[model samples]
Target: MRRPAAFLNLIFSRRSIRRFRPGKIDAEVLKIILEAAQSAPYYYQAFCFILLEKPEIKREINESCGGDFIEKAGASIVVCLDLNRISGLLDRLGIVHVLKADTYPVESVLGVFESGLAVMNLIMAAEVMGYGTLILDCALYECERISEILKLPHGVIPLVIVCIGEKDENPPPRPRWPLESLFHVDGYRMLSDEESERFLENMDKAYSVEGYLKKYAGWAGSYREYLANRALLTREVRRAYESISAFLRRSGFRP
Candidate 1:
């Protein structure tokens, strides 16, 4: 399929940028980008964004977020949803159906997907305007604290935080798995032991444990420990999941 010129430009040039030049994205441009984000499709619910603009606030957020790069970001956006607005929007937009009297699927599997579509639009808009952007799932800092700072009411779960700015470096394209390895024609087909070796052959060695250890220590090791130690994944994970549940319940999204 032939993509329109601007669409192709968005797809090719959109890269997650951590490093950013110290500057500001203009107000008009930021508004346009937000409009683009809101225009994204909803599979089951509607989500809104909270745009973080003030430098002092961004600095505070940077401390909580654990990344120095965030302090220089031109802007940050927190994607969230008002449960009823989402529920109503989903029904109105045909994103959700009244499957039964007291049951709704929007609260479960579909919310993330809705957010994904909206964020893509956000990225596309930022990229087209010559701004580099990074989707910060881990750099959002404290969700509840941010809610308090932003003055967001109960029920808004900030799923993804995006930081945007002028880019500094041109990182080389990382290798991708071969077409055959990634694209399966149909069905779940199990690979033979020999076939698995062949699959790994075409894959870049940088993805391997030894290769990763050369650049950064303890990545694969930590993962290995995660496999061995149940505590590694549980300590930080349960609270977040519980928080999501709490937000959902408070916002009228069950589960």
Candidate 2:
């Protein structure tokens, strides 16, 4: 096999950066990044990128979503699933019968999926240009507040906030499920009990080496325990779920 290209190496080296050095992204560079995002494949092109450089707006987003790192970044882009734009275009073209209520659910899913692909392109372009990126889903926890802050119209939902800036931290790459556990050839494979235990053991070892449990959840003895106690469906998580669900329905993304 041919050696992996530099772009593949860049993808492998990319990390979710939270701490960023103070600096402003040049307008031309940001334009290039956004153009790369627009090149992503799409089903309906139902997405919009709202670039936020104002400190006050970033601070408001931080307050709403509890992502203080957002204010510290050079800039943030809110990737919105904007079905409203598609609907407007359809109306302008007199395509009245296209977007019915039954199609809303499929369109919503496609919009979100396309938004993710565009976001990946944006992130990779930034990374290749020597900027760190952080994808924050915390916006989902306060979707209504984010909508208000961004002045989004109905059918426009903030799907993610991407923070871009120079890096200030160099944390180790986080662990993931083993390839055998995640990948399957031709069909899905159910993990055996022993395989599950091995995966957990590997994760525990990696997290232990990184002192992740000690720093984040001192009470938890292992990665498994930490996930169960702190990362699973806790009260705060349930509240976030409710908030996102309600906002999706109100924004016309759900039936």
Which number leads on lDDT? 2
Candidate 1 Cα outliers beyond 4 Å, as residue runs: 1-6, 43-45, 87-103, 139-141, 175-182, 190-255
Count steric clashes of candidate 2: 0
RMSD from true fold, candidate 2: 2.2
- TM-score of model 1 relative to the true fold? 0.71
Query: Taking the candidates one at a time, how many backbone clashes does each contain?
Result: 0, 0
lDDT of 2 by residue, 1-255 (tens): 996789888988898887899988889999999999999998999999998877888889988767477878887899999889888887888656445464347888888899999999999999999999999886666678889988899889988899999999877878888888889999999999999888889889988887877764465598778667766787888987887787788787854
Predictions in order: lDDT: 0.65, 0.85
- After the best TM-score superposition of candidate 2, give how far the Cα of residue 228 lies from its true spot, in angstroms: 1.2
Q: Clashing residue pairs in candidate 1, if any?
A: none
Candidate 1 local lDDT, 74-142, one digit each (tens): 888777754546545556766545422244544544766777888888888888888988887642336
Where model 2 places Cα greater than 4 Å from the true spot, the runs are 102-104, 213-221, 230-240
lDDT of 2 at 199: 82
